[model samples]
Structure formats: C-alpha cells, structure tokens
Target: MSSSPSSTPWSTPCGTPPLAGGPGGADALRPLVATVLDALHDGAAARGGPLPPGGPEAVTAHVRDALADVLPDTGTGAEEALHALVTALAYGAADPAHPHCAAHLHTPPLALAVAADLAASALNPSLDSWDQAPAASALEQLVTRALATEIHPTGPAPDALVTTGGTESNHLALLLAREHHGPTLQTVCGANAHHSIRRAAWLLGLPEPVTVPAPDGTIDLTALAAVLTDLRGPLLVTATAGTTDTGSIDPLSEIADLCDTHGSAFHVDAAYGGPLLFSATRRHLLTGLDRAHTVTLDLHKLGWQPVAAGLLAVPDTTMLDALAHTAPYLNPDDDTRAGLPDLLGRSPRTSRRPDILKVAVTFRALGRTGLGHLVDRVCDTAQQLADLVDKNPHLDLYERPTLTTVLFRPTDATDEAVAATRRDLLTHGHAVLGRAHADGHLWFKATLLNPHTTPTDLDTLIALVEGSTTR
Candidate 1:
C-alpha cells in the first residue's frame, strides 16, 4: 500500500534493531534469576528465627513500603519484584530443621528433594500433557508404581494421582467409593478416624457417615459389625492406620474381613502412617493395607517431602475411570490412548504441577533401605522419649506410642494447669508442642518427625513444661 506503511516508530526500520540486548530478552533475565536463587538458597541455610508478633498489619505495611520503593511507576518489572517479595518473606519463619518444631504433621524436607523442587520450579512443567512435561509425566507414573509395589508386591500395578494434600486425597477416595456404590452408599469409620473422613462424606453428597465408637481409642470390632448390620446397599468402611491425637492404629485385618463378609468397599486413610510401609519394625501395624479397595497417603507428612504431595491409590487401575471426563479442547480424541492417562482424568485438579520430581530425586538419593532406616530412626527416638516420660516421676505417659507421637501430661497437675502451661510454652517461643482431649482430660502432645531430635532434648522440653506449670 502506500510507501511501505509509512514506517511506524514501533516497527524496526532496518537490520534486526540491536537484537533486543544482543541475544533476545532471555539474556537480560538470566542474571536476575541467578541472583534470586542465590538469595533464597542462602536465606534457607541461615536457620532463620521465628516471626515478629505484629500479624497482618505489620506484614501489609512492609509490603506497601517495599512496593513503593522497588516497583517502577509505569510498568512492573516482574523478576525484580518477585525477588524483593521473596527476600521480605524470608525474614522470619518456622525453621523445619529446628529440633523443637514438633507441633503438626510437618517434616523437614530432604535436601535432595528441595533441590529437585528448585529444578522443577525452573522448568515449570505442567502434568496435563506430554508436550508440556514429557519426563515429569513418566516420573509420576514410575513413582506411583513404586509406591504401589510397597503396598501390594504380588498384585498388578494400580492407578494413582497426586492431590493437594491428605484432605483432597481422602475426598477422592470417597468420591470413587460413592460412584462405584450408588446414592445409598453408607460409610463406617472408627471414632478415632481423622475428621477429614467425615468431611469427605459430606462433600460427596452422602448421608452422615455411621461412626463406630472406639472405647479404648481402637476400633471396636463388635460395634463395627453392629453398624454394618444397620446399613443397606453397598457399604464403604474406612480403617485408620494412624489417628491424630493418640496415634492409635485400627484393626485393619479384622475390618477387611468384615467388609469382605458384608460385600462393602474398604478404603484406608493411611496418610499419616503410610511411611511405616518402609519401616520393617512398624510395617506389621498396617498388615491388611493391600486388601483395601483404595488408600490415601501424604508424602509431605511422613515421606519427608514438601507440602502438597498427597496420593490416592486404588487397587485396580480401572477404578480410576469412575472420575474420567473428556474435554473437547483440553484432551481431544487425537490423544486418548497413547500410553497417557491424562492425570486430570483421575484427579480433581486439571492444571497440576509435576510434584513427582521430588519423589523421584529422593528415591534416587536415598534407596529404599535408607528411607526405611530414617523412618525407623524417628520411631526409635519417639520410643526413647516415651521411655524418658516413663522414668520421670513428674510426667505421666498418656498412651504407648504405636508410631512417632508421644502424648502425655504432668502427673501432679490438674487439667487447667496443663492447659495454662501449654499456653505459656507457646507464648515464649521456647518450644512448640501439641494438645489433645481424651477421656475428658486435656493432655500435652508431641509428634516427633525430626530424626535428629534426642532424648535429652525431650527431657529439656519436659522440664520447661514443669517449670511453667505454676508460672
């Protein structure tokens, strides 16, 4: 058209226009990303202290000040902004490596796994399609198979998917159970089962789950049989591998036999105790896991992986078809059965990250035997702490630990005094412990996941609680 479109200023006039900083814009971002990675690595290594107690207002003010100072007025420089944001966030947070960080089901991530996480972030692979993440998709499949092998060595490999966490995995198991067994499907769970199982029933549009009372914090088989008699149609029974408060294990073998007799689908929520599969000493506790129709496990809690690494495993690969759906654009007819199961078809999430890299890297770094040793060490340390409690005249053992958790209370203190002492310990930031109610009394608790924790450290914690009882 007229005179070569009038030569707009935005368009390049001649000869490639300086090549956007001599090799395209990627060169400009390389150094910035490297700087950010260095800062993050160093910050994590320093063993930072806990947060200052100003809460939301202080955090918001810091954010506002940083944005005003670092961000450009006209347009945001994303890389720079991200670096500044991360630097500010790393100022104060709970150090998982700290021996006393024993409150929840959290664990210090393995060093190799952390490195793998960094690699995954840089690659930014999505598991939705092979084109997006070819190697990662294969790695996920391999890790799932490895985990299935641990549970059922003789059975065929089954289908599994990575979920957000234990909550989502439990939800998936409920959904699958409901789909297989219709609208009238009822569930039976022990009184000591994790609360998430009940929540899963509600989310899946099932009636309120039938609760089997566990008088001694272990599933009462007689009560379970009575509940099974009352339920109609297909039944779903959940057996707990490890409970929250007392770390009690349900009688899985007996529950499996009952489900078999009633023709019900048996599911196991082994999210907290699944790692015991690797420990020869404790593996017998989960004796009948292979018989369950489905099982849930959280790698973050006991596998020493980072957060959001949960899995839902089914006995047969075909069971996953219950959740399959075909999206026209997302997974077209062209890519249906090319050895790709389209992880989204089996899981609730679509745009899932390649979480399996950490698992694969961890396995390669520490072989199966090494992982088992680590788990056994943690349990041994827990027993050591329990022994301390037994030997001390001031502390009373609440229950014998079947796993790595120790629940106890002060021998001479009242319930109110125990509560006050726990509060005092939390306020001072000396150590973090847990609390629970059993038999109408509140007890102090600790979940020992850190293998480096010693009996002396627990003794000091007991002393701290005793000292604070009157304060």
Candidate 2:
C-alpha cells in the first residue's frame, strides 16, 4: 500500500539530494569563526539591553527576512552562506550578559569554557565507542568522578555522566529507575518539580504521576506523607533544589527520609541550585544533595558554561546497570571481555559529545572559591533587589529569595497588565524581566546571573518597572 522508503537517509527516490559537499569541513567553518568576531564587536557597540529593540512580531519578521535571504543554491560558497547565517544569529539573538536580560535561567558563558568548546567542536569526539574517542573516554571518567565527588563528597566517587540538560538527566534517571524497579513503578514529584519528570514518565509508559502541591514553590512536607500513603508500587520521587518560577528549594533531608522509608528512588533536580554546593557560605542550602539516589545539575544554567551541559550523579554505580545494553556489532561482548571502557550505556543517546572537556576547563579556570564568590554576588544582588522592592511603594516583593531569583510585581498591575508591560519593554528596548502567575496572582521575576550589573543597573531596572506600572 505504501511506497518503499528511500534506501539512503540523505536522499529520497524522487527529488535530488543535497551533496555532503566537497572535502574540508574545518576549512568551511572559517567564515563562521570570522563572523563570530564581527558579532562580538557589533553587539557591544549596539549598547542595548538584553534584547534588540523589537517585540514578538518584529522578531518573527526579522527571522523570516533572514531565512528568505539565504541563497537556495550552494553556489554562493560555504564562506558566504555561513557568514550570512552567523551574522543573523549575532544580530538577532538576545545577549544574556546585558544588564536587563534577567528574564530566564540563561547565563553568560565564561571565556575559557568558550575556548574549550571551540577545541571540542574541532576535535569532534563522538564518545560512543573507544575507537571513536579513546582519550575522551578516560577524560569523561576523570571529570565525571570529580563532579560526582562534588555532589556527594565523603563517599567514594559516585556514578556520574554529562547530559544535554536537566531534561535528559531526569529522563536517564527515570529510565534507570524503571529498569531497576520495573514498569509497575509510579512517579511522584512536587507541583514545582521541573516538567521533565512528567515527560520522563510518559516516555517510560509509567502510571499517571501523583503530584504533591508545592505552595510557595516548595513542597509542603506535611502534605507529602499523605500523598504517598496510598501508593501501591515502586515509586520515583523528584525533589527540586531550585524550582523554575520561584527558585524555591524543597526540604531535601525530609524528602530523603520519606523516600528511604517507602523504599522509593529519590532524584533531586538541582539544575539551577546545584552550584550552591561550591559556596562555603551557602553550601548549607544543598546539604541533602548527598543523600539523593540521583542528583541532576545543569552547567549551562549557572555554572557559566555554554548550553547543553547537564550532569547527573548517583550514589550507587550498579543502579546504572539497568541502562546497560549490549551491541554485538558496535560494543560487542568481546570488547567487554577485553575490559575496554564502553561508557555509552549510562545515557540515552549513544553518539554523544565530550562536553566534559569544557566542564573541566570551567572548573580549572574558576576554582571553587572564585565560583563561590560569583554565587554569593548574585545572591547579594537578589537581596538588594528584594530590599529595594520592599522600599518601593509601586513594587511588591512576593517572597524572600532562597537562591538568586527574586519574584515580585508592581503593586498596581493585573496579570494581563504585567504581560503587556513586558511586551512594551521588549518592543521599546527598555528592559525584559521574567513574568509568571502563581497563587492566583501575576508576578515578575529577575534571575541575576551577571555580577557585572551594578547598583545603578538595578535601579534603572526598578525604575523601568515602576514607570511601566503607572502606565
């Protein structure tokens, strides 16, 4: 009834397929390299807030125009084609380093990490097999052990690996739990848990999640026991170290005890707050991370790394056996018999990049103390903003910031009005702060990652919010 699928992935039976192009992959990317340098210069000169001066419609139109301008034929040469693409990205993309770009969890990348990425990209190490990545295999193990130690110190290096981000970390954790505990397991998480947990459940075909409400963005411990009382099978309980909207951390010690009592697997989504472990003054906040069965951390969020740098650490290495699979052709039993390190089973994706190099470079460049200072600086900014909001009659500070995010709103704005203000600010290139709705109220938020933003920048942002409130 159906036509046979094309034999080759690159082409169909009818339309002509684009060639992989003549030799020289590295040589083709020079234009992109040059364009990045140009972008840096042009971007700095723009002297704009986080984003360019345009709202949603304007952004869409600009992207469409760029796409339309790209030559359909490859005759324009790799240099010209790549130059145009990188130029579009340079001018169109928002700059997280900008003082007013406090809308999301995005962070400005460190220079050293960027250099590491350039090297890693050039090397193109695919760590699926030792043949593909020999040294990289060892490098990943060394870095993984170090990170696992950071998360669960005092114990021998726990199981660990790098992932795309928190979502993949959560997915891998659940996949392991399901393989160990079985398909009969039920997933549980606080209402404030990252959405990835639910997605993981669906992918695993587990039962509907029993979500415990997280008022104030932290789980109500009193209600947690009641929710788990009726569960019938093996369970996975996800705790949040830093919730998305409010940056609230759950009572991890208490949650650990409950999971232990019920024989359920515990996973902590510390994608945003995991960096607190580095802060000597603030390490107390993540004290219970060591007790988690599995803990997730995202280097891209606050670790000053480029995107797609998620990590997972576990106390028991054997738990990862659930994800182990044998491939007679690629990672054959013969290889295992020879005692070669085949690390692909620990993650969902087989052909993975050695992102650990950049992570290793980040820690080396910014040691624990330096990174801790950055964390403290952001926390200080959050407190300063909180106090400013408290003093300002037009602004309402909702909760004391537990981490680096401050949730608040204008004293005189409605839910729609708050959204309207954000749109206006973006359209006019004034400021762009986070907006969210919870507890039957609309709120604005600021996630301060850029320590370079001075008190004057903070005051300017507040003034923008105040001015918007009156309008």
Candidate 3:
C-alpha cells in the first residue's frame, strides 16, 4: 500500500518541499519566488557586463565549483539550491538585455511575458490531451486561429500549430509536403535560406534541395527560374524572408508568381521576419506571405517572448489534416465526436508545456499597435547603427539595414583580424557581437533586437569595434 503523506520517506528530517500546484501552492511559492528574485538580482549585479569576463574556461570552472556536489547523499534544501544555481547561471549568462549583447537573434523577454511564464510553470499543464489542458487547449485554439488569420487574411479557414521553433516548424512544413505528395517532394531554396531547410529535407527522406544563388544577399530570380524549369518532379520552392548571415528579404511577390507559373508549391521560412506583419510600414516587405502553402514563424527571435515560441501557419485548416494523428487514450474518436477538441494532432510532441500562456498574455497585454511599435523601434535602431557605420571612416557597412541586422567591419581589416576582434570582445567580456561572411570578407554582424537600445548604445558598439580592430 502507498504510504500516507505524513509517513512518506521524504517527510523525515529532509522534509519534502511544498508542491507548486493546488490550493496551498501560492503560499508555498511566495518565499521561494522571493529567494529566486533576490538571487537573480545578485547574479546580474555580480556579472557587471553583457557576459562574464574570462571566456569558456573561467565560466566553466566557476559553475563547476558552485555545483560540485551534484547528486549528493544529502540535499542542500530548496532555498539554498535555488539561490546558488540561479545566481551562478544568471552571472554566467550572455545577457541579451545588455545593449552591448547584439549578437544573434536572441531577444530579451518582456517582464510581463516572463511573469506569465511563471504562472505557466506553476500550473504545469501538459498539452497532450484535452483533459490535461482544457483551458490551455482552448486558449491555444483561439490564439493560433487569430494569428493564422492575420497571416492568411483572405483564406476561408486559416490555422496554425505551435512548435518548438524554426527548426521544428521547417520540419513540419516539409513533413506536410512529403505526406501530401509522397517522399518524392524536392525542395528548392536560395543559398541564403536557413540551414534547417536542408536538414529538414534530409530528415524527411526528401531529395537534397536545389540551392539557387543568393550572390546579392537575396536570391537571383533568373537562376531560381532556370532551376525550377530544369527540375521535373513534385517541387516545393522554399524562400527566405529574412536570411541569417545578412537580414535580406527575397523578392516575395516575384517568387510567388514564379511558383505559380512553374506549378510548384511555395513555402516561406519567415522565422525571423514573420513578426514584420505587426508593423504596418514593414508588412509590405512580406507581401506574398499569404500565398505560401506553409510559413514558418519564430516569435522568440523578434517577438520578445522566451525561447521556443514558434509556429507553422497554413492557409486552411484542411491543410493540417496531414498532421492529424489519433491516439486512443489521448484523443479518442468518441471524445472528439462528443465536441471535445482533438489535441493530439496539434503537434508532433506530446506532454508539451503551455508555452501559449506566455504568448497569449503578451498578445493581450500588447495588441497589434503596441507590438508594432516595438518592431519599428528595433528596425529604426538598426538603421541608426547602419548610419553610424557609414559615417565611421574606420568601419565599412556591408549594405543598408534590411530588417534589424547590420553587417560591418574595420574599414580594411583582414578576415583573420575581423575574427580575432570578435573573439577578443567575447574573451574580455567587453561586448557580444556575431560574425558573418559577406561580400568576400568576414564582418561584424550586429543583430539589434533590443527595443530599448539607444543611439548612444550604437555609438558605443562602433567605438568598441574600432578599439578591438586596432588591438
């Protein structure tokens, strides 16, 4: 027989920690949250910059020393363990909130969204079945439909499925194409497309993608047309809305028109630029987005939510029938027939966290206009950075800011010098900037995503680069 709570093994001197759910959960969590908040503040204070000083070895040693007693015979208790680990992690983090941390597509999450995430964690709703997440499943439906409608406004019934991120969204898009047209689907993408497209095609047993040239950062229309004409099987032309190395949007309407002419299905990997739909001024950049058979969107990149806020949108709900799966226990036919929403087919993974909660909260708290303002802010900041790069005789701007990525380097620095400067910044914890190869040279790629970054911050980044290059 199962022992009573009082007589359980954990109830001895060790003392079982209070659970995070049910009636008493809030009272139990209050002190623990305070501990965590304190720890976070202390850690960030300790870490004085965007990243901890002294690169990999120092950071690793610091973490190792703090966490030496992993799986110890006796616990350190909840508060101690929480404080120690949280503080260590926060201290060692490459904090995106720092204006100097304009490296990758990583975004610093909003306070409101992060707070909503806490509620999600405490509730711990698994989205595998309707019973597991009744309200969450309903909320997911409402939010997904609304977003899908925004993407495919003219469609009769648009729908979307939440995914882990761009990689999974790309995989699902390919999987759907494979399921509909068999394993013979051949993907065609520009060289500028995200690496996930090639990986997804391989995972789905589809032929390797026919990569067209992207010499000018965007795809070459004539080359793409030639490749599509030469190919003779089931074709899926994958286009990039925002490229990785350089944020350049392909000519969407022209590509969509080409797809129509060639009788090929179109898919846009808008993972980085999808949120441009929120910006009234920038939505025109994704003009033919609705024409795609599938679109990949990653909110984590541009939408300042936490990691893993991704989606795959379709023009019609019927298009998602390919992903329809039936697990007897999770989504029984009787339950579905009796008006219960079938949750199994929504995604490939079961037992998923309600990531939608944070996203929903963010959307409700900040409507289209609010979100649009944030988008515009970052893009404008990028333009300001580009202008700085242009004015700086020591720096060379690769091109004008397309979205929020600005590629530049020391005016005449060699590729090796450019690379060394980036590493020097990382090792010294002076700043965190990314590197990209474009126009036959390695350049510093500042992917500015922080809305609060000021003009002074951009000047500081250029000054840092100038200083690094000299060294």
Top-scoring candidate (TM-score)? 3
| Candidate achieving the largest lDDT | 3
Candidate 3: tens digits of C-alpha lDDT, residues 265-367: 9999999999999998999999999999999999998899998799999999998898788999999999999999888789999889898889999999999
Question: Model 1, range 241-327, lDDT digits (tens) per residue?
Answer: 878887788889999999999888999989888888987777988999989888888988878988778998876678888877777
Pull out the clashing pairs in model 3: none
Show where candidate 1 strays beyond 4 Å: 1-88, 337-341
TM-score ranking, high to low = 3, 2, 1
**1 or 3, which is superior by TM-score?**
3
**Candidate 1 weakest ten by summed lDDT:** 1-10
As for lDDT, the candidate ahead, 2 or 3, is 3
**How would you encode candidate 2's per-residue C-alpha lDDT over 235-341 as one tens digit per residue?**
88889999889888999999989888888788999999999988999989987889888899998987888987999898767767776877775588889789987
- Clashes in predicted model 1: 0
Instruction: TM-score each candidate.
Output: 0.86, 0.90, 0.97
Q: What's model 1's lDDT at 124?
A: 76
| Cand. 2 Cα-lDDT | 0.80
Residue 272 in candidate 3, Cα distance off native in Å:
0.7
